[model samples]
Target: MELFGTEGYVNVSVKKICDEAGLTQRYFYESFPDRVNLLAAVYQHCVDIARSATIAAATEVIDRAGVADGPVPAAVIPILAEEALGGFINSLVEDPRRARVILIEVVGVAPEIEKLRLGAIHDWADLIAGFASNGRPTTPKQKLAAIGLVGAITQLLVDWQMALTDPINEQAGPDLFQVDSVHEVVTEMFVATYDKIFG
Candidate 1:
């Protein structure tokens, strides 16, 4: 996670990671067949951490906001977004190494790397869809609505990336995902798009 985020795929070396871990070349090879595999592991582990944190933060925000239904919880949306966005920023914040490794190095180089990067986005989309529907949808309308809402949340992240500096919640807008119980406009995009699709 550290090196991958710092130096990126191209610059990171297995020798460096082994040195950091205080192990021999033999040990590094024993654990990973290639640098790419090692980097993939790092990416997966960090994303897992971020994903779990996002879910927990969302739940807590929802509970704190006293939001049970209507249009997905506002507090939770921002919290989830923060967790997702924060995880990456935490790695890259003021650290050029991580930025080069993660955000710069591997992107568009390989499909596998792209998969790792987008995994969390897809998961978050599912969550947004669930919030829009309050559960798995039983009807086409509901499912469509859920997907639309999820798309909104996913796109919010893409736009956030474009800003290049603002954190997710800040770039996404405090009101980015709020609608009904949500306080974010992006969330409202979920609501509006969902309704429009269903209608």
Candidate 2:
């Protein structure tokens, strides 16, 4: 994961990976058929981390609000959205390697990997739609909206990650990297979508 995140999947060799892990090629092959399989596992790990972080953050908010059993109150939705989005974004921002693997390295891989990536996106959409619907069965429109929102958020984060590497964006200052700004924008977008779909 570290090698893929830092050196990129295309650039890193299996020998290098084995050297990094102090493992033999035999051992590596025992676990994964090839580098792509390892990349898939790493990608899935990153996705799980982000999803777990988001759920944990939202659960904390809900627990604190004392609304564990019932639907989350509409009044707390914005705060919930902010914390949840922050958790998701911060998981990546705090680990640039993970961010690069997820947002950059994972793109245009093999067809199977692409399918896995799409499945991850739909899983995220299901999660967001579930939250927006407050555990209710999401309508097709709600599911579609959630998928669109997830795509937008993914692209926004990718742009943000790119800006971090682009020297021209340096003048944009520290605020550009602040997770709060990203969270605010996404939270507003999410809340508005929630209102449109479930208000």
Residue 36 Cα positional deviation in candidate 1, in Å, after optimal superposition: 1.3
Model 2: how large is the Cα RMSD against the reference?
2.0
For model 2, residues 139-179, the per-residue Cα lDDT tens digits are: 99999999999998998777777777652465554457455
lDDT per prediction? 0.54, 0.87
Error of 1 at 114 (Å): 2.9
> Candidate 2: where is the Cα deviation over 4 Å?
167-178
**Residue 175 in model 2: shift from native, Å?**
6.9
| Candidate 2 vs. true structure, TM-score | 0.93
Q: Any runs in candidate 1 off by more than 4 Å, and if so which?
A: 65-106, 138-188, 194-199
Backbone collision count in every prediction?
Answer: 19, 0
Please provide TM-scores, in order, for all candidate models, with all chains considered together.
0.59, 0.93
lDDT for model 1:
0.54
Error of 1 at 130 (Å): 1.4
